[model samples]
Target: MDYRFSEQGGVTHVTLTGQLNFAANEDFQAIVERIAKIRGGKVVFDLATLTHIDSVGLGLLYIAHEELAAVGSSLSLLHPRDTVLRMLQLTEASETFDIIS
Candidate 1:
């Protein structure tokens, strides 16, 4: 997936726009490094355009969550599509992360 990062009022939001799967690990790491360097307390994922977020993607998100939390930061998902929602429900992944409606 592709992501664009922006900051405002001390919040750094990374908006993802595309499918998040195995092909996107490099992109994920890049985003993570940028956010961590800035020490943003709130790491928001704007999934309004995310067509699908796969298991690998979920794993990456979990890693990101833990990393952020270690530094007193947090992660949140926003505007997930129906398919992604269903997967999260079935896998109980929603309960594990900060899934915002």
Candidate 2:
């Protein structure tokens, strides 16, 4: 997957596109690590353009959440595609994150 990072209203916004799968694991982790370094406020992942996600991608998301929380920040998943949304629901991920549309 490819992502664009920006800052607005003191919040970090990450817009992800393409497939978020194992192929992107290394890049995804690197990006998340960088994002985790931010001091505080919200980190929003805009998933509207994301087409697919696999188990590894989902795990990375959870890791990103925990890492950000540990730094006194937060992670929010936004505009997830219908299929991805279903995956999140099926996995009961809503309880672990704040998802916004």
Candidate 3:
């Protein structure tokens, strides 16, 4: 997986593309650390270009959510592709996140 970080209207946006799986763990952890510095801030994951995700990817999202919440920050998943969205929903992880279409 690959990601780009940008800022708009006081929100930090991370645009993800390619595939998200165990291979992305290291990179995703770096992202989490970066966002964790923003206390009480809003961070959005723009997943519109992300083509695929696996259980490991979902677990990473969950970990990110918890880390951000603990730091008083918010995390949102935006425009997830159909396949990725289904994975989230089927796993019942959607309810734990703020997802935006």
Largest lDDT belongs to which candidate? Answer: 3
Question: Which candidate gets the maximum TM-score versus the true structure?
Answer: 3
lDDT, candidate 3, residue 44? 99
RMSD per model, one decimal: 1.4, 0.8, 0.7
1-101 per-residue lDDT for model 1 (tens digits): 77888877877888898888889999998887777765538878888888898899888888888788777787888878898877777789777688887
lDDT of 2 by residue, 1-101 (tens): 89999999999999999998899899899888889889687899999999998898899899899889999999999999998998888899999999996
Kindly give the stretch of ten consecutive residues in candidate 3 with the minimal lDDT sum.
Answer: 92-101
CA deviation > 4 Å runs, candidate 1: none
TM-score of each: 0.90, 0.96, 0.97
Error of 1 at 33 (Å): 1.2
Q: Between the candidate structures 2 and 3, which one is better when assessed by TM-score?
A: 3
What is the lDDT for 16 in model 2? 92
Query: What value does the lDDT take at residue 48 in candidate 1?
Result: 81
Please tell me which model should have the higher lDDT, number 1 or number 2.
2
Candidate 2 regions exceeding 4 Å error are none
